[model samples]
Structure formats: structure tokens, C-alpha cells
Target: MTKIANVRCQLVDLEPETARSDASQSFVKQETVLVTVETVDGMSGTGYSYTIGTGGTAVVAMLRDHLVDGLLGADARNVEQIWQRMVTGTRATTVGAITSLAMAAIDVALWDLRGQRADEPVWRLAGGAHDRLPLYDTEGGWIHLTCEELVRNALAAKAAGVRGVKVKVGKPSLTEDAERLAAVRDAVGPAFEIMVDANQCFTGAEAARRAHSYESLGIAWFEEPLPADDLAGHVRLAAATTVPIAVGESLYSSLRFAEYVAAGAAGIVQVDAARVGGITPWLKVAHTAESFNVPVAPHFLMELHASLACAVPNGMYVEHIPQLGAISRGGHVIEEGWIRPPESPGIGIDWDLDAIDNLRVA
Candidate 1:
């Protein structure tokens, strides 16, 4: 039986090439926790998870000092058991970010090892529902962009054959946000989709007000319209507007997602694999959404999400934010607004290890 022989975790800090901003948060840099798991038979798999800009070291330290020790002598293929062990071991922090992020890094590495052993890609192993997924561009729609810039970028994306572009909402004036969306819609025409994200910047009343105006512009969905924990607010927002209320990236647990799904609070579930504790739980959340007939449009980590999005039938649009451009070894394919899952065995991220080593800060 293959057994986990060693585990290592390190921190890497990657700066964005351009400034990114939403209503509530600004894009500074991304801090990822890289994890490597080696089996006794001399095979190794790599996986990682991230924070938008901070807490990388805490995740790495949790993996190195606490979570890694728990896996010694355990069957490397027993992903579920290992995930539960990590969850139970870190009971104090299980519902929090640091613990979930640490567990995600390890869980992902374990899945990579499993896929490598089978000589199959994770998408196939997980259940290949589709080989190609539609892409949506978020990089071009940051809150700081002028209305002209927004229209220019949306038109550019349309020219490139992308299906949609996500615009940041929550400008000081609702009229400004509306005008921007109006310009983009008029530029891209009726065929192109425009998604709006508020990044949890609104209260129930405010989100309702904006959602009403957004619906008139034919937005595809209203993302993070209300705070993630405000399930009632989401329900109200979902009811008040015909626009789909998309949420999930800010949520930390499958149970939390279950609550949202059960309440019919969200129409699109934006499950982030890193935030949801890796591929195992991410799939659980995805399937959970499927059970409720809600579509999953996952948050960042495009390189990895492209595979997961293809693996499930309920998976929808994959957010296109090239955060790993500098560190990714570049094997996945994108053609005419569609992403083809990597054929490589495992999660398909070919990290430049040397670059990662150089970027490690802790």
C-alpha cells in the first residue's frame, strides 16, 4: 500500500500585473500556500491554496507544524480519511480560514497523488462531465476602470469570443454603476452576458435596490450582493430581483453552502476550492448545488478550477483571472472563449518550482 512518506508546505507571494479592485476589497497581491506530498514508493504530488494577500505563513505553518504530522503512516490514497483527520485535529479552527486553507492544501496534494497513481487527470477521475467550459473575464471589469475603459474591455472580450464579462458594482452612485453597465451592454449587444459583483458590499435594502436596477440592464447575475453570512438578506435579494444572486467564495464550509442552497438564497454558487477545503469538499459543495438545481460558477484559481469545472455536470462558467501567470508552468489550453481541461495526470498545474522557491517568503 502506498503511504505518505513526507509532507512540505511553503509560502509564495505573487504580485498582480495590474491594480484590481471590487467594492469591498482591493487586489494587492496573492499569497499561496504550496503543498507537496510524497509517497513511500517514491511518487510525489503538488497542490496549493491561497489568501488574496495575507495569511500565507499561517497556513504554511499549520500544514508544517500540525497537519503534516497527522498523516504519517496513513494510506496516501485515503483522501476522505485524511481530510477528516485534519478536520478533527484542527477542531478548534475547522470553521475558520487558516485551518480550512491548510487542510485544502494537503487534501489537494493527496488527490494529485491519487490521480498520478491512476495515470489519469483529476477531471476524469472525479467524473468528466464535460471537456470544455465557457470562460468569463473578470480582470477587465475592476471598479477603478472608467466607463469608457469598461466598454472598451467588454467589447474586446466579445471580440475575443468570450461568453461574458463580470463588472464590479457598488460605485458611490448607483447611476454611475448603471451608466457603466448600460455602456457595456450597448457595446457588447444582447448576445453577450454581463455579470455584476458587489463583493459583499451591500446590506439587504441596498442590494435589493441595486439588483432592481441591474436587472433592467440584463445582468447575468448579481454576485456577492449581500454579506455571505446574511442568508436572509440573500433570500430577500434573490426574491426582490429577477437577477440571479451568486455567492459562495466567502463561505467556508459545505454545511454553510447547504444552508444557502436549502433556503434558496442563491441562484449561482461560486464555490472556491481553496476556501472550501480543496477538491474533496469543493466537489461536495458542487454536487450539493446540483442537487438543488443551482449552477456552480467557481471563484478564482482559474488554472485549477478549469479542471474541476469540467469534472462536474452542474459546473458552469469558470472565472478567468490569471493570478498564477508568473508562477504557472502553462500547459492548459484556451480557445475562443472556452477552456480545455489539461490532459496531464493530476490537477494540471505545472508550477515552476524554481520560481516558487525564489518567491517563498516564509
Candidate 2:
């Protein structure tokens, strides 16, 4: 048995090349909490989770003062056992972000260690359902961009062989959102898919109103229109429109997603691995969606999410938002529109330790 010998955490502040803005908030920077786990067998694995800007220090503290201690001396290959131990040990914070993110970092590292020991990539280890997944671009579709900007970016993604572009909605008027989407649709033509994201900026009533207008433009899905907690609201909104309702990023547990799925509220499950208590629950949620015959197009951390996405049969698209480009030594291969999973064992993030070390805050 490979015994875990050590666990470490670091806080790094990463600024986006361009600020990202959606209807509800602006991401001026990201604070990533990077975690590393080493086993007695001379093998180590790295994993990470992040906050938009704040609360990273709390995640760092949680890892150092709390989660890390529990992990030391455990069997590195017993991922599920370790995961449950971490979750139950932190029962007080179980339903919140800090506990979930902390668990995610450690749980992912455990999985990474498992993959490395077996000399297999995480996708195959997790369950290889597909070799590649189609890409969707969200970089150029932020709410701050103008119609002309939207068209230019959407066409660029299409030219790059991306299957679709997700434009941020929640403009002052439904007409305004429709006009911008229309501009993108007209620019890309009917061949390229157009999705819309509101980032939880709408009420159930407002979401339903906008969903109708979006449907007229042939949107692929209406994402996070209502807040993540409003399962009944989402169900009402879903019944009111033909466009699929996508959620799960803000949700912190697998049971929450099961509730959403069981209610027939979420049509596309965008389970963010970090937010859902790491790969263990992420897998549970993905399979949960599969049982319901719903497609999963998980949230960010594209590098790692690509592997997870390709692992499950119902996995659909991996959001092509490259947040780790500045700190990572390498990136994923996007050939024609689909992303090919990294052949390297474990999660594919190749940290330039020098760069990451320079930005380390804890």
C-alpha cells in the first residue's frame, strides 16, 4: 500500500489577461489554492481549486490546519475512503464552499496519486467513455463586449473549429440580449451553435421571459439564468421554455444536483469538480445525470475537466476557458474542435513550479 506521507497547500493570485465580466460579477483576478500530496513510495500528485479573488486564504488555512493532517498516513490508493473521511471530519462545514473546496483539492490529489501509481491517465482511470470532447468558447462572449465584439469573437471560435460559443445575457432589455445573440447567430450562420449564460442574474419570471426570446434565436442552452439554489424556480423556468437549463457550478454537493435532476429542473449538468467536493462526487453527479439521461458539460478547470468529461459516457462539452495558461508549463491539444485527453498519468496540469512559487501567498 502506498502510504501518504505529506500534504501541502499554496495560495497563488492569478490575474486574467483581460478582466472577465458577466451579469452578476466581474472577475478581476483569481486566487488559486494549489494542493500537493506525496506518498511513501516516492510518488506525488498535484491538484487545485480556486475562488474568484477572495476566500483563497481560508481554503489554504483549511488545507493546512485541518484537511492535510487527516490525510497524512492514509492509504493513497483508497480515494473513496479518504474522501469520506475528509467530508465527515469536516461535517460542520460540509454544505459550504470552504469545506467543499478543501476536500476537492485533497480528493483530486488522491486520485492523481492513484493514476500515477497505475501509470494511466485520469480519464481512463476514471472510466474512459470517449477519447475527445467538442469544445465551446466563452472567453470572447463576456457581457461587457459590444455586438460587434461579440460577432468578431464568435466567428473567431467558429474559425478555430469550436462547435459553439456561449454569450453572456441579462442585458437591460430582452430585446438587447436578442439583438446581440442575433448578431452572433447571423455572423456565425446557422451551422455554429450559440449558447447563453446569465450567471444567475435573473428571477424565475425574468429567466422565463428571456428564455422565450432566446429560443427564437435557436440558442443551444440557457445557463445559470436563475440562482443555483432555486430548484423550483429552475423547474418552472425549464417548463416555460424549450431551451435546456444548465447549472451546477455554484452548488457544493452531489445531493443538490440529484435534487435538481430528480425535479427535472436541470437539463444540462455543468458540475464543477472543485465546487462539488472533487472528482469523487463529480463522478457521482455525472453518473446521476446519466441515469436521468441528461448530458453533462462541466464548468471550468478545463485541463482537468477535459479528462473528467471524456471519462463519462453522457459527458457532452468541456468549456474551453483556459485559466491556468500563465502558470502551467503545458496545455491540452485542441485538434479540429475536440480536445484530446493528455496521455500523461494523473491530472494534466504541469505546473511551472518556479512561476507558481513566485505567486505563492501561503
Candidate 3:
């Protein structure tokens, strides 16, 4: 048995590729918590989770002060067992952001180890349901961008072969939001996909109103139109609109996703691997969404999500928001608007160790 010999955690602060803002918050930086788990035989794998700008230290502390000791001598291959142990040990913090993020770092690292030992990519290990996933640009559609800017970016993405671009909705008025989306729609034409994201900015009534307004535009989906915790509101909004309600990025557990899917609140599920705990639970959420015949277009972390999206049969699109350039070499190869998962073992991220060292803050 390859017993876990060492576990290390570090914090790296990375700036966003561009100044980004939506209805909810501004992304000032990515406070990433990186974890490395090494076995007694000298094999190692890396995993990470992030916050937009805060709580990175807490995530690190959770790993160092509570999680790492439990992993030091456990069977590294028994990922599910270790994951459950961590959840049980951190019972007080289970199903919350910091604990989930901490577990995610370790859980993904274990999956990485599994991939390396099996000599297969994480995608194949997870499911290998698809070889590639279509790409959509979210970086180009911040709420702060002007209508012209949104149009230009959508055109650029389309020209680059991207299938769609997400336009952030939640201007001061509904008409303003409509105008902005209309401009992008006019520029991209009807054939290209346009997804509108409210970023959890609207009330159920407001979300329903906007959904109705945007439905004529032929958007791919209305993303996060209401707060994630408001299941009843989402159900109401989803029922009231022809536009699909896409949620799950802010949900912290598979059970929460199951609730949304079961309630018919989520027409499209957008699970984030890091936020939902790790690859283990992430797969659970994906398969759960699949059982309901719902499509999953994951949230951020494109580098990690690329492989995960390909791993699932129901994955719809991978949102494009590159944020790893400062700590990694190369990036996802976007070929004709689709991203192919890296064929290498583990999670498929090509981490730049030197870059990570330079940015390490804890």
C-alpha cells in the first residue's frame, strides 16, 4: 500500500486577467490554496481551490491545522474513505465554503495521485464521457463593459471559433440590460449562442421579468438569476420563464444540487469542482444532474474544469475565464471553439513550480 507520507499546503495570490465585475462582486484577485500530497514511494500530486479575493489563509489554516495530520499516514488510494474521514472530522465546518475548499484541495490531489498510478488522465479516471467540450467566453462579458465593448468581445470570440459568450446582466434597469444583450445578439447574430448571467442579482419576480424579456433574444440560459440559497425562489422563477434557469456554482454540496434538480429549479446545472468539495463529490453532482437529464456547464477554474467537463457525458460547455497564467505554463488548447482535455496523467494542469514559488505567500 502506498501510504501518504507528506501533505503540504500553500497560498498563492493571483490577479485576474482583466478587471472583472458582475452584479455580485468584483474579482480583485484569486486567493488560491494549493495542496500537494506525496506517498511514501515518492509519488506526488497537486490540487488547488480558490476564493475571489478573501479567506485564502483560512483555507490554508484548515489544511495545516486540521486536515493534513489526518492524511499523513492514510492509504492515499482510498480517496473516498479519506474524503469521508475529513468531512466527519471537520463536522462543524462541513458543507461550508472554507471546509469544502480545504477538502477540495486534498481530494483533487488524491485524484491526481490515482491518475498517475493508473497511467491515465483524470478525465478517463473520472468518466471519459467526451473527448472535448465546446468553449464559451465569460471574460469578455463583464457587467462593467459597455454595450459596444460587449458587442466587440462577442464578435471577437465568435471569430476565434468560440461557440458562445456570456453577457452579464444587471444594469441599473431592465431596459439597459436588454439593450446590452440586444447589441451583442445583433452583433453575434442568431446562429451564435449568447448566455445571460444575472450573477444572483435578482429577486424571483425580477428574475422572471428579465427572463421573459430575454427569452425572445434566444439566450442559451439565464444563469444564477436568483440567490443560490433561495430554492423556492428559483423554482418560481424557473416555472415562470421559458428561459432555462442555470444555477449550482455557489452551492457547496451535492445534496444541494440534488435538491435543485429534484425541485425542477435548475434547468442547467453549473457545478464548480472546487466549490462542491472535490472531484469525488463533483462527479456525484454531475451524475446527479445527468440523471435528471440536465446539462452541466461548470463555473470557473477553466484549467481544472476542462478535463472535468470532458469527463462527464452531460457536460454542455466550459466557461472560458483564464486566471492561471501567472502560476502555470501553457494553457487549455482551444481548437475551433472546443477544448480538448490534456492527455497527461493526473488533473492535466501544467503547473509552473517556479512561478508558484515566486507567488507563494504562506
Candidate 4:
């Protein structure tokens, strides 16, 4: 094997002009860390890890001070060792969230390099992957959206061939939440898959009450009904209501995933591509959830997950918000409710460096 050669990282500030809203928060900006790793063989790979908006600086710092230092001269093929070493650094500061975002950026690049080396796509390398992955539109719903507007997006999703549609809930009280779900339910009807996300904006009891109310509407699942770290609350909501809870995007660790799995707190696992350290731990989590018979439905960065979802048998659905289309050189195309996974090697989604650079604020 060629000696591991050079590694570099960059922090990018990509903010949207207008804030896009969801149930719990508004996305006023986006922050991404792009990691590029090069090898002595002249083989190079690209990766992306995300903090979304505010944590880009911290993530960039970890790479400059710790992550890149650890990777220098390390065997590029020893992906596991590199990953473990990064994890070790976690004992002190625990890259849990910060480092994983960094790890993901690097890991994805490495995987892309691997695929290019073999002249094969990532989905093929991961295993025998399907050509398409089912998708559900997240609709980018905000708190200000009227019930009718929420329903309109749901209809749009159905018209787009999306088999499933997810909407925002948690409107300050259970009564309002129920009313919103009711509107979305009526708009889309009983056959179309409907899911609601609280964005972890409610108390355990509030989550439970909302869950109970939506049960009659046949909601597929309740997402992040309680705060991400509220393990006991997760358990409470899972137990108290007939609706199963879904979470993991804001969740930071495999051990935490184990916590939710063991407690039977979450039924649907929504892992993020960049959040859990690129494809490595992301795949690990999918495999882990499979053991518990839980369905894996990934969160944002749908571009990256499109291939991943097809490669894994347990993948349930991909959430589509459509804003990233402007940034991604050639964004994933949504066709008849299924995304045609990128045929390019590695994660397959093109980063559009110029676009990324053009959007850089700092």
C-alpha cells in the first residue's frame, strides 16, 4: 500500500437568504465542512460532514487541530483504525457530534476514492444496491404555514409520486398539533403515507398526547416528539401512545442509538449521512438497527443517502426538502416518489465546488 500522504480540510459557510421553517426551528443558514484526503498513489477522495449552520467553526477546528493530525501518515486503507483513533480522541473531547461531522466529510471522500479506484459506484461497492430509493417530501413546512398550506404541500408530494409525506407538528399545544395533523390527514387521505415531526419541541407528556391524538389519523410514526436527549421521555412516548416514535438525526452516538433501540423508545431510525461520520458509522447504525428489526429511514443530505438507501435492505424512505438543489451541482432528481440513485462512483452526488465557493461567506 502506498504511504498515506496529504490531508486537508475547509470550513464553508453557505447560508440561504430566507429562513426555511420546520416544526421546531427555521433554517436560516447552512454550514458545511468539506474534507479532502489525498494519497501517495495520486488517488484522492472527497468527503462532507455537516453542522448545518452554527458549528462549522468548531468542526473546522477539530480537523485542523486533531483529526488531520491523526490521519497524517496513517494507512488510507486502514479506514477502521483511523475511525477508531478519531473515536479515541472522543474520550477527552469526544468528537461525538463535532468530530462525526468532520469524520463524515473525510470518510465520504475516502469512499469516493475507493469507488473511483475500483471504477464502480458506491452503492455497488456497499453491496448489491437497487437503482432507486423510495422518497417522501418533508415539504419544508414552517410554524406560520396555515393548515391549508400544510395540506397543499402534502398534495404536491402525492402528485409528485411521493408515496409518503411528512409534515411539521408541535404547535405550542396538543390541541393545535392535532388540528394540523387532522388537516394534513384529510388532504392526503388514508392511503397515502403520512408522518409528523415535532422536531423534539415538546415535553414527554406533550409528545405522548400528540401521539395519541394522531393515532386516529393513522400517522405512520411520530418523529422527535421529545428532545433528542430525553431518553426517558422517548421511552414514555413510545410506551404511552399507539404511534411509534422516530428519531436519530439530532442524535449523536451509536451508544445513544443503542439506548433508543434497547429501550424500544424509537421504532423508526432516521440517521443523517453527515451527522454520524460519513458512511462508516452511518452504515454501522443501519446494520445495528436492522438487528433490532427497526426500519432505517435517513434524514437530510438526501443526495448522499439516495445511494445508501438503495444499498440497504432495511431502508424505509428518504426525506426530501428540495433546498439543497441550489447548492448541489446536479441535485438528486425526484421522480415519481423514488430517487434514481447516483450512478457515479462513491456517494455519487457532485459537490459543485464552484457553487460551494461562490456561496462561501467567510
lDDT of 4: 0.78
Summing lDDT over every window of 10 consecutive residues in candidate 4, give the lowest-scoring window: 322-331
**lDDT tens digits by residue: candidate 4, 308-343:** 877777888887755455557763666788887777
- After superposition on all C-alphas, the RMSD of every candidate to the true structure, in Å, is 0.9, 0.9, 0.8, 1.9
Separately for all candidates shown, the number of backbone clashes (residues 3 or more apart, or on different chains) is 0, 0, 0, 7
Best candidate according to lDDT: 3
Give the clashing residue pairs of candidate 1, or none.
Answer: none
Pairs with steric clashes in candidate 3: none
For candidate 1, write residues 123-210 as lDDT tens digits: 9899899999999999899999999999999988988889999999999888989999999999999889999999999888888888
For candidate 2, the 10 contiguous residues with the lowest summed lDDT are 324-333
Per-candidate TM-score against the hidden true structure: 0.99, 0.98, 0.99, 0.94
RMSD of 3: 0.8
Candidate 4: residue 144 lDDT (0-100)? 70
Instruction: Kindly report which residue stretches of model 3 are placed more than 4 angstroms away from their true locations once superposed.
Output: none
lDDT of 3: 0.92
Model 4 residue 350 CA deviation in Å = 1.9
User: Against the unseen true structure, what C-alpha lDDT does each candidate score?
Assistant: 0.90, 0.90, 0.92, 0.78
Between candidates 2 and 4, which one is better according to TM-score? 2
Name the lDDT of candidate 1. 0.90
**Displacement of the residue 231 alpha carbon in candidate 4, Å:** 1.7
Cα-lDDT of candidate 2: 0.90
Give lDDT tens digits, candidate 2, residues 1-362: 48989888888999886769999999978898888999988899988898987789898888888888888899998899998898888988888998899889888888888888889999999999999999999999999999999999988899899999999998889889999999999899987899899999998888888898888788999999988899889999988899999999999999999999999999999999988889999999999999999999999889899999999999899998888877897657889889988889888678899999888878
